[model samples]
Target: QEGVKRWLNGRDDAAFSRWQLSRQREGQFIDLLLAVRDELDRLYRQPLDEPSMGQRKARLFEQLRERYQQLKQQWGGYAGFDGWFSHDLNNAYLASIATYEAWVPAFQQLLKQAGGDLAGFYAASRALGELPSPQREQRLQALLQAADP
Candidate 1:
């Protein structure tokens, strides 16, 4: 095993190898997270009438939450200086996710108010969708006005 090899190779050697492995895992995680987020973004725009849209949304949510929780668990604890730095950035990202999750009900309500048709008001709002949530909300509100009249 890599760990066994590292152990036999000595402490300094182990440290570098350990860091290398961690960096590799981090890269893999980032690629996976980006891909899944893309999936979520693409699938989320579907109108409710599509037969499999609900299933797709559910799958995306499950994937998102699983990765979110995995990262939280993976990075949650103290790991001296290196971890303290990553921890700050990780916590900031998780905080944003928390804020976004809190908005889910409101987003769903907006869909309801639109009578569940996301394409009309929503399709015209992709530029806003690319913004951060607060800015996106403002842009979406402006788009809604345009879409309506």
Candidate 2:
């Protein structure tokens, strides 16, 4: 919707300009979040048994830290911008959190049904569970560390 040149092409309409900016920020946030999540999935798929867990978890946190910074820094990208900027951010955050909560439990149950692959599933879930808040950094690291054999 944002690429519709007729609507968002010119800076003439302040509302349209704001809408474009908000869309850009939203895209950036989603990109970063997805990238971090993809890395988590990669970690889970790796065949390493024990020693690599700490290293992998550390890398995951580093990627997440970058994503968090990206979100926080670009947060001001919508400042004074209009067209549901705050609403978009809030909704995105809420949706991300809610989706994770829904996904993790359902995923755990699915893993159990498929047999015991808790380690692989939890590896991703553990990282995602830490993402909603900064305070979980330490605990998440510890959990990931302990997840190692």
Candidate 3:
């Protein structure tokens, strides 16, 4: 009975430690998210102050591509190699969605502040001067299929 009680107490202490570690990780994740956003803001908004469409488009695309690269690196590590692989993926997905949400206002403000047509600029931005919508969708679908665990 005494041994069982000691084991239970040990388990409880370990569980509490794990819970604390999880909270610390969450805080770090938030910090990472904020840092990414700050990078995006610096890339997009600061350049827009001088008002160059080409530069704005380039900066925005660069930031978007960087985020995608970062996410893939975070999420797609080899099995049993990366300790936080699953956690990284989940955090990346959440961060990507949050970043998109953050962009809504920045985009709106850019259009209003710069007196540009937001929809037209965005449509052009989406095109990225290459493949059409259908081809892009097909490529994305293929990538998603490939990415499945």
Report the lDDT tens digits of candidate 3 across residue range 23-85: 554454445556655555555555355557445645644554455456546645312222333
* Candidate 3 or 2, higher lDDT: 2
Stretches > 4 Å off in candidate 1: 1-11, 49-53, 61-149
Q: How many angstroms is residue 59 displaced in model 2 relative to the true structure, after the best TM-score fit? A: 3.4
| TM-scores of the models, in the order given | 0.33, 0.38, 0.29
What tens-digit string does per-residue lDDT give for candidate 1 at 1-149? 23344455656776777777666566555554556656666665766666687677667656655665566566664232234234323323534555554454455455555666666437534554778989887754554454432
Please give me the total number of clashing residue pairs in predicted model 1: 0
What's the residue-level lDDT of 58 in candidate 1?
61
Q: Which stretches of candidate 2 lie over 4 Å from their true place?
A: 1-12, 50-55, 70-149
Error of 1 at 105 (Å): 34
Q: Which ten residues in a row have the lowest lDDT in candidate 3?
A: 77-86
lDDT of candidate 2 over 1-149, digit per residue (tens): 41254556675688777777767776665565566556666676888877796677666656665556556666853333233233423224534754554344445443444355555655755765667666555544454444423
| Global lDDT of each candidate | 0.55, 0.55, 0.49
Clash totals, every prediction: 0, 0, 0
Cα RMSD (angstroms) for every candidate in the order listed: 18.6, 16.8, 19.3
